[model samples]
Target: MGLFTAIRDVLSGFKSLLIGMRITGREAAKPILTVQYPRETLKMPARFRGHIQLILDPETGKPRCTACTLCEKACPSECIDLDGLRREGDKKKSVSKYMLDFTKCSLCGSCVEVCPSDAIEFSKQYNVVSLGREQFAQMDLYAKVEAEAQAWAAAHPTPPAPPTPATPQPAVTPAASIAPKAS
Candidate 1:
């Protein structure tokens, strides 16, 4: 009876192994989902949040950030450092420096949501890497935004205002055309 039980246990283990092998073979027949890393890259979805970037105003050709520091306040990781300089007699402040620490950032979109001016949004730059720890540790997004704004301005110059048409005058003045009534 003991020998028979041992033989049965060995047969059960073999059956389980065969079942696993069959499943694996079936799955192996399907096309591979993996793509070549560098030579062939996969496109990210539209909503993929790679990082934060600033929007620049076309009219002023500058960053749209009011530097309210709302984004900084909203960031959970405290990765955002936004600073602005107030002019002597100005009510609004212009962004002086803007930095982001991507290592700590969770890309939760909290900062983007809290921004009142719609100044910042998630960037499409998904391929971010650093050669060393110091490199790309703290990125100044404001400078990149300014440079892009300038480039856009140069590329898309506002067309010159249409030349004003000369105002038309009556071919003949009423008094001049109307002969003095013969008295």
Candidate 2:
């Protein structure tokens, strides 16, 4: 309320803080409960979910994404953005713009959970640093995959088979046509 009261409040706050410090100091002197970080990686619990990643199919050189956005909707932070592309023949559904902004991502793992095609996942890569915003925003999750597919297609183009000769068939005519019209 007054200048004296304000000074008294500040002193009380300092006393409370010192009391907390004393309690922590006592705990520190006792057997350490905190695990050593980095050198000794803490065991993450099964419930401790992590970030989302896209895995490519080795044989097909394509992601398992079937254009299903279950993960996108499932994410509370709305970090996963999937751009669905058309299949070569079908021209209906596939993923064109597969993007996951880990910056905005809260590492909730909702994307991994809801992925039906098993394309999106939690990668083992724990620490990835980026300088520019563009570098961090890695949209081309399947760049390596696309390149592989291109190489395969080029290597194994369909061979053109030689044309086969058709068998000759005898032409047939009616008896009346053979006798000619009786005009």
Output the number of the lDDT-best candidate.
1
Query: Model 2, range 13-55, lDDT digits (tens) per residue?
Result: 9999999999999988998677676677666565555556566
Model 2: lDDT to the true structure: 0.71
TM-score of each model, in listed order: 0.70, 0.51
User: What's each prediction's clash count?
Assistant: 0, 2
Q: What is the lDDT of residue 178 in candidate 2?
A: 84
Candidate 2's TM-score reads 0.51
Show model 1 residue runs off by greater than 4 Å: 1-13, 58-60, 86-92, 158-183
What are the RMSD figures for all models against the true structure?
Answer: 5.5, 14.7
Q: Which residue pairs in model 1 clash with each other?
A: none
Query: Which consecutive 10 residues in model 2 have the weakest lDDT in total?
Result: 136-145
